[model samples]
Structures are given as C-alpha cells and as structure tokens.
Target chain A: AQSVTQLDSHVSVSEGTPVLLRCNYSSSYSPSLFWYVQHPNKGLQLLLKYTSAATLVKGINGFEAEFKKSETSFHLTKPSAHMSDAAEYFCVVSDRNGNEKLTFGTGTRLTIIP
Target chain B: GAGVSQTPSNKVTEKGKYVELRCDPISGHTALYWYRQSLGQGPEFLIYFQGTGAADDSGLPNDRFFAVRPEGSVSTLKIQRTERGDSAVYLCASSLMVGGRDEQFFGPGTRLTVL
Candidate 1:
C-alpha cells in the first residue's frame, strides 16, 4: 500500500521569512511524489513533483522540495513567505506498479503573517 | 481546453436526492481521476479511468457512488441517495501519461452540499 504523511498540521511564518512544511511517504515501488497547494475557494494547483529524476525539484511561486530517499521525506520549502502563500498544502504519492492512483496526506495549513 | 474543467461549481441538494457532477479533461490526455475533499482534509482518491475503462475504483466509499468516462474524455460522477456526509468538493484531474510520469492537473472542482 502507498501512503503519505504530512508531518505538520499547521505552520506559520512571517512575511519575508523562510517557510517549511514537511512530508513523508511509504511506497512498495519506486514512488512519484508531488506537492500541491489549495487557496481558499479555488482549485488545487500543482507546485512540484519528483519522478525519480532530480533529487531537488523546483516549482511555481518560488517553491521547491527535495526528494530524500534515505529519509523517506519530501519536504516543501520557500525562501520567503508572502501573504498569498497562506493556504492548504498536500503531499501526494503514487507508484508506477499499480494504476498510479495518488495517495494524499491529511494536509498542512500554512499561515502567513504580515 | 488547456486544463481540466468541472461543471456546477456549487450544488446544494436535499438528502436522498441524486446528483451528477461532470468533468472535462485536458485534450489528448488518456488518464483521468476522481477525488473528494472534505473540509480541512486533502483530496482522497475515488476512482481512475484509463481511456474508456475504469482502471481502479478501490477508493470508492460505496456503491452509491459511481463514475463513467463514456468516450474517453468527458466523465460524469453519479451519486444516488446522497447523504449529508457526502458533502465535499469533487475534484477531477487528468494526466498526460507522458513517459509514465503521472503528474495530474486538477480542475476547479464541484462543491456538493447535501442538506
């Protein structure tokens, strides 16, 4: 079975400060991971994904995550937080072996303080 | 269209009524997926369709929920006797299936409220 866990339920960062939201995963096969953000009342948007090619993946809005096999972690980070960054973030995992259905973590709600 | 699209941005229904949500995947994409997101929770997998066939549906909560992709592009999720607990945002996504990367682009979602 494939599953994902977002280590933090909530994370708050002041504007212009660094931000971090941690995630972990478990998969039987080589895993494909992704980070997505959902702004209030809007569609979920893809931030980035790791398909086993590059350990570090960069995404929209100056976000990035490193795929750490040894740690079973795929943590999302940003150099600076903006007020618009306040939203819900999800960590998803899918393996090549099955139908590639995504397994999602509960989610981490990020709060940006001005 | 460039991205996935879903209809009925919001729906309010009485308990036990039936509802149908629609999704239009990105053009030329062969894989489509359905998910449901409750308040404060991440989206949960509901089903997957490869072309015109349902490849996986293990995540469906019960038989009351069903989905179909008739022509391999537009899909509809059907619900029977909707309950209050069934209220959620139904999300649809499509994958290009390029090199098996499986990165899915999502739709705005159909918010269903069962009262």
Candidate 2:
C-alpha cells in the first residue's frame, strides 16, 4: 500500500516571506509525487509533479517542491509568500506500476498574513 | 476545452435514502476517479475507471457504494441506504491516461449532506 504524510496541519507566513510545507511518502515502487492546492469552495488544482524526470519540480504561483529519495520527502516551498497563497495543500503519491489511483495526505492549511 | 464536471453542486438528503451523483470527464480522457472528502480531511479514494471498466474499486468503503462508467466517458456513483457518515464532498477527476504519471484534473465536487 502507498501513503503520504504531511508534516504540518497548518502553516502561516507573512507576505514576502518564505513558505514551506513538509510531506513524506511510502511506496513500494518508484513513486510519482504531486502537490495540489484547493481554494475555498473550489476544486483542487495541480501545483507540481515529480515523475522521476527532475528532482526539482517547479509549479504555478511560484511554488516548487524537491523530491528527495533519501528522505522519502517531497516538500513544497516558495521563495516568497503572497496573499493569494492561502489555501489547503495536499501531498499525493501514486505507484509507478501504472496504478492510476492516487493516495493523498491529510492536507496542510496555508495562511498568508499581510 | 472542457474539464471534468460533476452534477448537483450540493445535495441534502435524509438517512436511508439512495443518492446518485454524476460525472462528465474531458472529451478524450480515458481515466476517471472518484474520491470522498470530509470536513478538514484529505480526499479518500473510492474508485477508478479505465475506459469502460473499473480498474480499481478497492478504496470503496463498503458494498453500499458503487460506480460505473459504462460508455467510457460519463460516470455515475450510487450510494444505497445513505448514512450521515456518508455526507461529504464527493469529487470527480479525470486524467489523460490510466498511468501513475498523468495529472488528474478535478471537478468542483458535489457536497452531499445527509440528515
């Protein structure tokens, strides 16, 4: 079975400050990881994905995540936080054996202060 | 140009009643997925369909939950004897492929509230 764990339930950052959301995963095969963001009353939007092509994956809205095989982590980071960055983020993982089903983490709520 | 779409943005039903939710995937997407999200929790996988067949139904909580994608495009999820615990935001997503590397595009989700 595959699973993902988000280290933080909530994270708050001031505008223009750095932001980080930690995540870890356990998978039997080579893992395909992803980050998704959900705004209030909206569906989830894909942020970034790691499919073994690149360790450093860049996403929309200045977001990026590094896939560290050694740490079993794929933590999302932003150089500077914006007010619109406040939303719920999820870490996801899928089995490399062509299993289309994705396992999601509990989620981390991001709050950006002005 | 169309994305995944789900019907009945919100549903309120009494316990013991049956409910059916609908989903329409992108024009050529061959893969569809269903998930349930409770308040303040991550979405839990329910089922996955590849083409006209269910590739995976292991995440289904019980036999009361069932889904079908007969024509390989539109799908329906049926829940029998609805319980309050079944109340949640039911999300539908679709991807270009049935592989792990494909990105899944999501719909607005149907918020089902059981009373």
Candidate 3:
C-alpha cells in the first residue's frame, strides 16, 4: 500500500517570502511521488514528480520538491510566494509500475497575504 | 489540444437516485481514471481504464459505484442508489499511455450533491 501525508492542512505565507509545504510518504515499492496544485474551481495541475531519479525535482510556477529517502518525505518549496500561488496542494504517491492509481494526501491549502 | 473534460459541472440528486457522470479525455490518450474527492479531503481513486477495459477498481467503495469506457476515448461513472455520503466531486483523468511513467491530466470535475 502507498500513502502520502501532508503535514500542514493550511499554510499562510506573505508575498515575496519563501514557502514550504511538508509531506511524508510510505510505499511498499519504489515509490513515485508527485505534487499537484488545484486552484479554486479548477482542475488539479501537476506541479512536479519524482520517479527515483534526482533527489531534487523542479516543477512549474517556481515550485520545487526534494525527495529524501531517509526521511520518507517529499516536501514542496518555493523561492518566493506569489498571489497566484495560493491554492490547495496535494502530495500524491503511486507504485512506479503498472498500478496507475494515485493515492493523494489530504492536501495543504496555501494562502498568500499580500 | 484539449484537456480532460467532464459534463454536468454540478449535480444534485435525492437519495437512491441513479446518476451518471461523463468524461471526455484528451484526444489520443489511451489511459483514463476516475477519482472522488469529498469535503475537506483529498481525491480518492475509484477506477482506471486502459483502452476499453478496466485496469483497476479496488478503490471503489461498493457495488453502487461502477464505471465504463465504451470506445476507449470517453468514459462514464455510474452510481446507483446514491446516499448523502456519496456527495462529492467526481474527477476524471487521462494519460498518454498505459503506465505510471506518463503524466495524468485531470478534469474540472463533476460535483455531485446527494440530498
């Protein structure tokens, strides 16, 4: 079984400040990790994914995440926050093989205060 | 190129009514999936299809939930005897191929509210 846990349900950050969203995961196999962002009334958008390649993965919109095997975590970060960055972010996990089902975390809602 | 599209952006039904949600995947994508998101929670996997056959459906809550992809391009999620607990957003996603290596694009989702 594979699962993801997003540490913060809601994260508030000021514009121009660095943003951090913590996530931990558990998987029986070589896990594939992904971060998806959902704007209000919009579809889920793929930010980044880690498939056992480089520990550091870069995504769209200036977002990035590091895959730390030792910590069983894949935390998302941004160098600076923007008003458009405010969205519900979900950390997802899946088996790297044929199990195409994506197990998602409860999600972290990012709120940017201008 | 178009992204995934789902119809009936919002649905309201009484208890025990049957409902069907449609999804039109991106053109030429071979893999399709269904998921459900409840209030204050993440999207939960429901089923997936590779071509016209179901690839996995272990996430389905019960017999009340069923899905089908008739021609391998469009899919539908059918729910029978709906309950208030079934109220949630039904999402459809599709990928280019049949493996986890591909990225899945999601649809805007159909919000189902069971009354």
Maximum-lDDT candidate: 3
**Candidate 2 residue pairs in clash (backbone atoms < 3 Å):** none
After the best TM-score superposition of candidate 3, give how far the Cα of residue A35 lies from its true spot, in angstroms: 0.3
Candidate 1: regions farther than 4 A off: A97-99
Q: Which residue ranges in model 2 land beyond 4 Å of their true spot?
A: A97-99
lDDT tens readout by residue for model 1, B1-115? 5889999999999999999999999999999999999988889999999899998899899999999999999999999999999999999999876337756889999999999
Q: What would the per-residue lDDT of candidate 3 be over residues A21-114, giving only the tens digit for each residue?
A: 9999999998999999999999999999998889999999999999999999999999999999999999999986533999999999999999
Kindly give the number of clashing pairs for every candidate.
0, 0, 0
Which has the better DockQ: candidate 2, or candidate 3? 3
lDDT-superior candidate, 1 or 3 = 3
Name every residue pair that clashes in candidate 3.
none
Candidate 2 vs 3: which has more lDDT: 3
Window of ten residues with lowest summed lDDT in model 1 chain A: A94-103
DockQ numbers for every candidate?
A: 0.55, 0.70, 0.71
Q: Against the true structure, whose DockQ is highest?
A: 3
- Over the stretch A3-98, how does candidate 2's per-residue lDDT look in tens digits? 999999999999999999999999998989999999999999999998888899999999999999999999999999999999999999988643
Q: Lowest summed lDDT over 10 consecutive residues: which window, candidate 1 chain B? A: B95-104
